[model samples]
Target: MTSAAPTTHIVFPLYPGVTHLDFCGPHQVFARLPGVHLSVASEGGRDIEAEGLVFAGLEDLATITHCNVLCVPGGFGCVEAMERPGFMAAIRRLAGSADYVTSVCTGSLILAAAGLLEGRHAACHWAWRHMLTEFAAIPDEGRVVNDGNIWTGGGVTAGIDFALALVARIAGVGVAQTIQLALEYAPAPPFDSGRPDLAPETVVNGYREKLADVLRDREAAIRRVAAGRANRASQ
Candidate 1:
């Protein structure tokens, strides 16, 4: 009799203010895989509300010391999360022991803050792609980027694509494709405004103007976290 393959263990750290789709999009793809165990982690295992922006599920931090794959998702609350005591440290601890470290959207920034993405090529939301450099990461374009055991996704919906790619890498193309087909993952948006280049100038400029303050704050937050990581490294 052949021995069964060891189950692939996956965990995603959940926190208040995590974007709903950022966590769920990729989550759905991974949940479809066979012989995979998944869980969501939050501080104290408390209910998470995504900072009231989206109705993400409730989860608490996993007590496990390590996992096969660990993921982090991003949202407006990331800035606050960066300022949260012991959060990045916990992430650093988990990523250090994980076989694979992954992130979605600005979540890569969080991973960077945790010192996981340093010296790694990764992907992030287009709006914040440049910020990856603060943590010594090389930025790439498109929906997904794979650099060794570190995988990252761009924006929100890209999580789905990233997870599918990760699944193919772990299992097989056939398995991932079957999951995609089962989910009917085909997407056809009515508008061509997903990216700034494709969107009308007015729409693009308006959003940029509106988000300038938020981006500035995010930059400041990154600097603070980067400093903290550097301090710990030198210690």
Candidate 2:
């Protein structure tokens, strides 16, 4: 008897400047599953960089046929990627077809731009939640948010939790717990600034300073999305 191929497909969309951890953290967990096919997709089939790390052999966006799960990672490049018409269209296609669509940090912004977060409760990097208002999304600002088939995580490292939650949903709680234990997933951050509620004024202000420029760009992207939606409505 021949073995049947697994149907689950995990698609990772790569941009010019993705964060390594944003892709790798959840990727490591998903890759652990047997028979799960993982594909790194880009606007074209080319090499991409993530925080100075180069990833080779990514598929072009046109090559994406279907996916059981889709992951959009965040980084400095996201400012451009989230605004690209083709990129947002590709994400919208995947999110509309995928069994589960999820994102890490500002990756949620990309989904929001694709009009996927409308009326959805989602999570995003605490520093960037204000932008979610533009998408008509209720931002959780939590480590993870599960809104039916869509999942989102806060900041970079939270991708791990996002992936684990998917695992729990797909395989079972035992499988998810096993993977978590194997990864030794226990958290005790030395600093309290990981979340805004716990962050001190100085730390919060510092984070604000770091995000100011990105926030400006994000505002522009949100405006673009709004304009696009308006144009589509007029059509």
Q: Which 10 residues in a row give candidate 2 its minimum summed lDDT?
A: 221-230
Residues 1-235, candidate 1: write the lDDT tens digits: 9999789888888777789899888889999899988888788777788655533354556466778898899988887886776677678887887888999999998888777777899999888999999889998887899998899999999999999999999999999999999999999999989988899999999998999999998898888878877888899
Residue 212 error for model 1, in Å? 1.2
- List ranges where model 2 is wrong by over 4 Å: 2-5
Off by over 4 Å in 1: 51-59
Clashes of 1: 5
lDDT of model 2 at position 65: 78
Estimate candidate 2's alpha-carbon lDDT, on a 0 to 1 scale. 0.85
Would you list the clashing residue pairs of candidate 1?
17-50, 17-51, 42-60, 42-61, 45-60
